[model samples]
Target chain A: MSQRSAGPELLRLIELMARLPGFGPRSARRAVLFLLKRKDQMLLPLADALRDAGEKIDRCEICGNFDTVQPCAVCQADGRDDGVICVVEDVPDLWALERGGSFRGRYHVLGGVLSAIDGIGPDDLHIGPLVGRVEAGGIREVILALNATVDGQTTAHYVADMLEGTGVEVTRLAHGVPVGGELDHLDDGTLAAALRSRRDVKR
Target chain B: MSQRSAGPELLRLIELMARLPGFGPRSARRAVLFLLKRKDQMLLPLADALRDAGEKIDRCEICGNFDTVQPCAVCQADGRDDGVICVVEDVPDLWALERGGSFRGRYHVLGGVLSAIDGIGPDDLHIGPLVGRVEAGGIREVILALNATVDGQTTAHYVADMLEGTGVEVTRLAHGVPVGGELDHLDDGTLAAALRSRRDVKR
Candidate 1:
């Protein structure tokens, strides 16, 4: 025997599965076996869902969010505050904000941050369309909801510079200790920021 | 807005993905986003592989292993010691043994071990077919390469009881410290078993 564990079809499935995020060879093998064990319930549905999403899903031309429509559901939805747009680094970040149900504004996905080491420039993101959206007017404020990394801050600074003369207020998420966060567990920078931005008690 | 983060198509995909073995809601969301970002390269190929596997893969009638063919590659392969059959708890265990390239004998996958808590019994497994193969009168030895868990050992005992009068020898995997295993980290049962099964060193 040639030491081949499974047939080509099963092997191919395992190979592709290992490439997925958060999976390696061993976990992928375990997952494939799990799928095979419940072929009708999980394997077929996941396969169909993948194909359907691939064929039907399209990026929103306006905000770069993915949906089954030309302008994504968020972009097409009514009553969303169109005057205030929140700029996120990626779709997941947009989803994260939306899940909180606090942000009632629109969103613009930048696709990625401006990473110097990765050779990603401002032009590589949706900065042009974002500027166009602001220049087209009626927008009062732009919320930069990017990550707290160095790349994210640099990208936010660059975006703020780009919209300096647009007459629209460009703001960012506040830097402070998170809700339910322990000061002892927080980093020195976060603690310092929290202390610096301390507020007075109304009572 | 209805608090919907994404469209129904993308939502369904995420729902199905969250059902995988190692993925939860957060990791599934991350993975789906990663897939959508590489729709043409990763998502499409994964979907294609899944559909192909679902349509093409078959369970081996003789040994209960999955492959593209009926009897599977392991069953049909020559030069294997047909007289000795290595019994495994599932197809993954068979694959693990095959990857080692040390087992020259054929395999018999039991689908799963007997689990009383889960209401799993001999009838739920491939034990009947295994006994039939042994009774067909060419098999000389049966190696119970099962896990060392309580359910596994109980099932092994039950199988040995069923094959009591078959005139065929029944064996089990050795209990000992594993390769690169540390003595300090070894469990009491394993240390005792290893000491009990010690053999004299050959000159």
Candidate 2:
């Protein structure tokens, strides 16, 4: 493995680097070497950043989004519609929705969806907190922006059932052909969904 | 770009991570998020490892390899043949050779090969120090274990020419079809080299 060639400390760095999402063993080695080469410019700054993030970044108390602040920027921001709440699978989904710049409401991050195979149930996700938010009143609408997967749908239905008597209007992202998608390349399931939920033309 | 969603520290971390060899903008974001998610297990350890490596790891005085020690592990190791020196293009090449565990000689890292197009010459490399090591007398043979590229060979020849009258026997890695390689998928140059350097089978 050439693990012994580079000292133990450097090898440890490579091992930890390999654990990162996009890096495998080979790429991790390359990354560690690159970091070593640019110690002043990259290595030191990254180390400092990681330490700072570990200390500063935390889950938002209100929305479950990650931020340095307790309530998170989205929850604390002014001029946003406090009446609507977008429920997403995780922080990344919240970030994706924010990147679109369309949704003006705050978000409630449901840590993950209900997965039967993975042993994840209602309690495993942030569904309890979500229901609590809706039950406390003031929220008029809740958008279930979960992924269009089997687990996601099951979780969405489960959440909807939980909020039945709460007087909140539940909605979900539309299932159809994606914007800029070619119908010929789409699966039969998506085509069928698009046909069933066909919207009327405004013109 | 949703860059503002994450705080300034995290955004800065992502920016620096994008400069790493294997990570691009998208993957850098994924990596940063992954680190943030696993703060105690992965993030803290990685940050500590980087800081340790940055503080300890430096170029070996004798061999030019990156190491926590002055002469590096390979240069300081006992039982290796001190009389034969293996010259390579970079630290990764040295690590690759070490992983193979075949060569028992020490190495001299050239840092880079001669590239006229890139303005890299002998002086830019550790060629003078290598010659000095050979001239000081114990080295009997020098193996040019560089890559089989045009620049690698040109650098090899340049190094050999510089050591002309030093009584050091200069050698290079033999060109052939790679071990366990199929003939059909082999390149023309490799097939030709394998055929021309055909060796007699021992009875």
Candidate 3:
């Protein structure tokens, strides 16, 4: 292979980029070269930003979102409708809903849905804390924005069952999402349509 | 628009990722969350790798290729045949040829071709240095591995004309490549075919 002309620092950057989802060695090289060409405009700023973020940020204590503070701005917001908490399987889903600008509430991330075959159980999820939040607070609605996976539905049903006598309104994001599709993959129109058509889940 | 549930660090990562070539906020958030969840396995290592790379590498002083050293390993290597120098417009082209496991000689990167419309003249390139190298050494062949663009052809001819009396063989890559196609986009097989079918340019 033609050796990289850059020093250890650039080589490290290319290696890290290669580990990203779709970047291969060729693309990684191109990307690194491009960044180097625009070092003043892109590379140095990106480096400083990443380093600063890495050194300063932490996970939100209340809902598991990213934030500079302990509970995150969303969880700590005074005006947010805390009575309605949206529960999602991943951070992307929460971002999607927030982008719609329709929901003005807080969030609860399960990290991932329960997958028995994958050895992911209830304890592995944030389900316990969700139940605790519902029981301890003045929660009126718990919007389940989980994916339309078999596992997602299973976890949703499990949560709904657990909170049955707690007299809380439990609903799921509507159908129309393709099977095994991720919330992040859906277009804004499709996501909005799904949200608009949401149906309640009865235990 | 979706509020980050994790922390500012995660949000910052997602924001930074969204600015990358093909990623959007949604995908960025998903990627950041995935990296975070797999921090020990992916995120932390990636972050460390980025930091290390940003701190170590530099451009090769001789050929403008990314390198850790000034002259770089390519320029310092005595094993590379000095008789035939393959001249390319960029380092990526050199790397592409190298990936095919062919070509055993050293290289001269012109950085870019002569584009009068873009105000890129011979003086703006490393052509003068290349000529000096050819004149000062026992160089026999100068293979022009520049793109097949009109500008590339013009630059190649100019270089050939400048080195005429030096008794050095000046050759251009074959026209097997279609017009307007970038060498970077061509496959190894196509590139190999082109190289094997290289034609001599009549002055």
Name the candidate that leads on DockQ.
2
Candidate 1, residues A25-84, lDDT tens digits: the string is 989989998888788999999999999999998789999998888888888788899999
Task: Sort the predicted structures by TM-score, highest score first.
Answer: 1, 2, 3
User: Model 3 chain B — which ten-residue stretch has the worst lDDT?
Assistant: B2-11
A11 Cα displacement, candidate 1 (Å): 1.0
lDDT of 3 by residue, B166-199 (tens): 9998887665677899999988877898898777
Stretches of candidate 2 off by over 4 Å are A2-4
Tens digit per residue, CA lDDT, model 2, A1-203: 56557999988998999988878988998898888888898999999998988899998988998899878888988889999999999887888888899999989999889998999988888888889999999999999999999999999999999999999999999999999999999999999999999888983
In order of DockQ, best first, we have 2, 1, 3
Residue B143 lDDT in candidate 1: 96
Instruction: Order the numbered candidates by lDDT, best leading.
Output: 2, 1, 3
Which lDDT tens digits does candidate 3 get at residues A1-203?
A: 44533445655667777776766777777777776666666665666566556556666777876667777777887878989999998767776777777888999988889998999998898888888999997999999988877999899998898888889999987666777889999988778877887778772
Q: Which candidate, 2 or 3, has the higher TM-score? A: 2
Q: Model 2, B11-127: lDDT tens per residue? A: 788898899987888888888888888888998999899999999999999998999988898988899999999999988889999999999899999999999999998789999
Q: Higher TM-score: candidate 1 or 3?
A: 1
RMSD of each: 1.8, 1.8, 6.7
Better of 2 and 3 by lDDT: 2
Instruction: Give stretches of model 3 more than 4 Å off.
Output: A2-11, A116-119, A176-203, B2-16, B22-26, B38-41, B114-124, B149-154, B174-203
Residue A150 in candidate 2, Cα distance off native in Å: 1.9
lDDT per residue for candidate 1 within B102-145, as digits (tens), equals 89898899989999899998899999999999999899999999
